[model samples]
Target: MNDQDITLSRRRLLGSVGAAGATGLALGGATGALAHSAAQEEAPTALRSVGATAVPFHGRHQAGITTPLQAHAHLAAFDLAPGAGRKEAAALLRRWSRTAGELMEGRPAEDDTAVGRDAGPCSLTVTFGFGRGFFGRTGLRDRMPEALAPLPRFTADALDPDRSDGDLWIQIGADDGLVAFQALRALQQQAGDAARLRWQMTGFNRTPGATAQPMSQRNLMGQVDGTNNPKPSEPDFDERIFVPGDGSPAWMAHGSYAVVRRIRMLLDPWERLPRGQQEKVIGRRKGDGAPLTGGTETTPVDLEKRGKDGTVVIPANAHVRVSAPETNGGAAMLRRSFSYHDGFREDGAPDAGLLFVAWQADPLRGFVPVQRKLDSGDALSAFIRHEASALFAVPGGPGAGEYVGERLLDG
Candidate 1:
């Protein structure tokens, strides 16, 4: 019969089965079934999903100048009360999005395309997402809420000591350093003492042609990075995003996992290196992301090939070598790293580098393991140092709510 008829038939069969059982047994069985159903419903999705949008420059700012508009990233964790008002929080987000766009000359809206002037008045666009601990049939689900059915997927996570929890992360971008601080102040007012927020700022000159390239391409090293990242409009987006399961609930199908790293790059040492040596270290041309072994950026790397007297051409411990296909464990993470040019030394020298952001399905298999392997003395490590690191559990699907440890504040 038709799908609706089949559903009705199944309901009738269940009803008949219940009627045939004794009253006491039926009641006990129903309660047990409900508990089982809740447990199944609460399980996190198998794959992480992501949705992202770019805010471009369209106003009086230097279209290509690399040193005017400063960029910064911020993150915070919330210890939400058991009955905290999520609707009010979501309402604040909606209001903030509108106010931020207005403050930036109407450029913060999802579809707004107007670019603002450099070093001029600007607004901020705030993107939101759910973490792994937020999903499922917990009481928090009924309390936490979202304005829309499918929330925008932006990279934001709190600092988790272990890799088991996700933090409520909010990233703010602006033209002026003061503006960034102002945005954070406003967020704190709305969130109150219910949540704790920690933020880091990275200010740099906005480069021309930035809008033409993907977010993952621009790095502090003045190079187009992460050319190997999955393209946004590719057909594989669904596969990379949603978990595989016919019985999976509709709400959790479109969520993604997020990972954040506060990496400090030693630019002086790197810039000191001869351009040729730099190229060799990265295993690719600095100007273009082409492999040293030859071919375009998209070409598969020839990692197995030997150079000269049978030594590996790319080298076993090179940044690209360790991060490449040879040691990635056959898993790919969509990276959207941002160059942060702040935290200068006492002598007025540059000290900051990149806020490395990556998204994938499984943190253990996808990011953690790969990073652990790379930490074993890769060439890139010479120029870069991991000053701070944390893992966040990003939840997937609809009706997914705030993180698990969030209710600790209520206690």
Candidate 2:
């Protein structure tokens, strides 16, 4: 379409954007009047500034690990087709990587679908990783990182075997739904005979510019989540989240380990609690996510502060207290998570919660320790169920002429 036509199309799309019960930029004209049709034709799209944004496929590390959360996401796993081995796996990675590289640039892949043909890149990212089963299936068991070992069972776990583990994992994210879906569909088609889909989950976060200003996102439970995530500026941020350049296994050098969990939040019971009680469960003000111990959201939590009644301000079993780094020997994980809702269950409770993807140099020092402590006494556990889990070794990003996992696959 020509520039004028494109501008007019977007104006119409924006005019009808808002839905009764939707998140993100649902409505453009809630109170203010919208531009007349004639004027709209001369105006630009609201998303025009951010639409052309594109994340480079090649980098020191994969895009999604530390990349800011996108508006839409698709998390999927795949098992190698029967008889597929190292050579097949390597070939599949090449094909998948090529398609991923192209799609992230807002271009159609070799096996193209027109689903997102008219959309911009939208800052699309496609990340690839390998689960524990991947090494064995490809005759590379000796090279599997210890960090990819099975996660120890937790008290809150009610895992589904079918959806838990896979030989391969892919995380696709984008500011626009269609862009994310385009990557997911293209990669799945590229897998062809080498890998078969195991389990897939679609998720979303508040769309970019959905609010007056960017801030920590609220989960389905209506709580500000991930308030204390490790910032990239911290001196130890890279060491905590990604392996050292000279780290073990050689291939995992710049890579990070990802612990993927599908935690289902039981909203019925949680919402029933008085607002006061709900805040106690998380130990943070629901409005701004500040600790009950006080200050803004970024204020350091004072775990030792007590009330006049001789009780701790932040409850002993509060989720934040039990999961804090200070209490867990400095263990921390970069929680790049997305909220998921799969309608309702047979019992009628909304089957919605978090697609919790935590990244760390090693699970032994990251997710495992903190999760163990949470299992022991986290009050939030009472209202959530751990439904699925998997650990993937995400290798460093590919360079010119290189594909993901190339070092290990060819080692």
Candidate 3:
């Protein structure tokens, strides 16, 4: 399109440039507006700012780990195709990386699906990781981090093997659903003959800018989750959440371990409980997530506090009480979770719950200890079932001109 036509097209696409929800510019009359439009013919197209906010694909670490939770996400795992060894894996990663770089910048890949062509980048991110089976498949087991060890069985687990682990994992997130879906589709196509899809899960959170004020998101059970998530500002945040460069296995220096779980809440039984009973089960206020012991949401829990009846406030078996770091030798995980609903079950009950994704320097110290405690006797466990689980070693981000896992795959 010519300069004049391009400008006019943008103006119309953005609705007269000054109309409500447009560019917010107000060029009063047609004469004045035409003059302004002509002067700005060469100016970049303005189609609202949502799509313009891009997250760079290259960095010291993958984007989704510490990145803010997005509105939409797709978590999928793949197994290397038969006879597809290290060489094939390396080539696949190269193609995947290039496509990811383009998509994250709101640009189309060479074989773009056009699903999100009209939208901006919307803060898209694609994170890659290696599952335990991946190492065996590619004959790189020696390079896999010890932290990727299999999790011990839990009492509350009803895991489905088919939906559990795979050779490769991908996490795609974006503020826009179409953008997220487009990225997922592109990556799947790129896998081609090198890998085959194992399992996939879709999830979502409250949309950014949807709430009048920022707050922790609520799950389908209507409870505020992630109130005590570790922040990057904390003194021990990096030490606790990411692998140290000095640690063994050079390729995983800046990486982290991810514990993926599909926890299904028994909503029928849970919703039957009274509000007061539910609060006791979680040991938090139903409305605002404040500890039953007292004070606001951010206030530290007073485990010592007793009620008028001399019973401990914040019930002994409450979910928060059992999972608290203090109760588990300072164990904690950086939870970046999303709620998922995969329609209804054959029994007609809603099939939904949290796609619990937690990151830590070591799963043994972070997820294992805490989860073991919960499995033993957590009151919340009665209303939730662990349906699927997987652990992955997510290496540091690839440098410029390098694809993810290039070090290990190409070594």
Each prediction's whole-model lDDT (CA): 0.47, 0.85, 0.84
The number of the candidate with the highest TM-score is 2
Cα lDDT tens digits, model 2, 190-265, are 8899999999999999987788966899999999999999999999999999999999899998999999999999
Q: What's the TM-score of every candidate structure?
A: 0.58, 0.90, 0.89
Write the residue-wise lDDT of candidate 3 on 292-315 in tens digits: 987888888888899899999988
Best-to-worst order by lDDT is 2, 3, 1
Backbone clash count, each prediction separately: 24, 1, 1
Alpha-carbon deviation at 53 in model 2, angstroms: 1.1
Clashes of 2: 1
Count backbone clashes in candidate 3: 1
Least lDDT summed over 10 consecutive residues: which range in candidate 3? 20-29
Instruction: Please write out the lDDT profile of model 1 over residues 220-285, one tens digit for every residue.
Output: 776657776665477764355333333133232333445666667778888889988887788777
